[model samples]
Target: MLEAAKAVFITSGVDAPAKEIADLAGVGVGTLYRHFPQRSDLVKAVFQREVDACVAAGPALSANHAPGTALTEWIDRYTEFLATKRGLATALHSGDPALEALPAYFMERVGPTLGALLDAAAASGEIRADVTPRDLLLAVAGLCAPVDHEGAAFSRRMVAFLMDGLRYGAVPPEPRG
Candidate 1:
């Protein structure tokens, strides 16, 4: 049900009706309500699920691919994750105490995972050593912020440029005269 809600939310915004989520989940609205008594409950669940998936991808990606490739792919995935998250930002910041902790939660869950990826790439000499996980994550978030169906290509180009910058000094600079 949370997965269904996530898909619907991506398409229809977090303000999407419960019935729409239930219909997509192939369940009745009552079931959705029974599980999540409040809309915030449902939204929180979807947000947590997305966070978990993005964090888990880091290790799996690193294990399967080269450090540079994994980091690049992970950044792309992180951008996609951020796109979904933007939909939930309003509700997550709605002055509800329960939702108030989410930004910290996001950093806690995602920061170390991204840090590990950054460390791996730097250790492998594939990217610069100066870039911190928080810095890279913020850069990706900024590039992906204005994301829409039309702006996705522009976002990709921006991310690619960021990635190139990350690799700018993978080899030593030429000696100056």
Candidate 2:
């Protein structure tokens, strides 16, 4: 249900009917309600699921690719995560205290995972040593902000530019004459 809701939410926003989510999940509306009781409940579940998926992808990415490649690929994943997150932010911020806790929750879950990736990349000498996970997250968030579907390609190029910046000085300058 959470997966179905995420897909529907990306296309239809969080206000997309519960029946739509249920239909996509191959479940009945009653089943969806039995699990999610309220729309907020469903929204929170989807949000947390996305956070979990993003967090989980880090180690796998780091393991499968070189440090620089892993960081770049992970940034791509983070961009996608941000895109979906922006879609649901409005509904999640509508004054529910529980829902309001999600931003902190997102940082708590994603922070360490990202930190580990940064640590590995820096230790491997693939990116500059000064960049922190918080810095990267904030930068990526800014790049992705004011989400414009039509501007996705532009956003991606901007993110690529940011990644290039992170790699600045990764190779020591040629010895001066």
* TM-score of every prediction relative to native: 0.91, 0.90
* Candidate 1 Cα misplacement greater than 4 A, ranges: 147-149, 171-177
Which one is best on TM-score? 1
**On residues 15-109, what C-alpha lDDT tens digit does candidate 2 reach at each position?**
99889999999999999999999898999998998899999999999889988888899999999998888769788788887699898999999
Badly placed stretches (over 4 Å) of model 2 are: 147-149, 171-177
Cα error, candidate 2, residue 24 (Å): 2.0
Clash-forming residue pairs, model 2: none
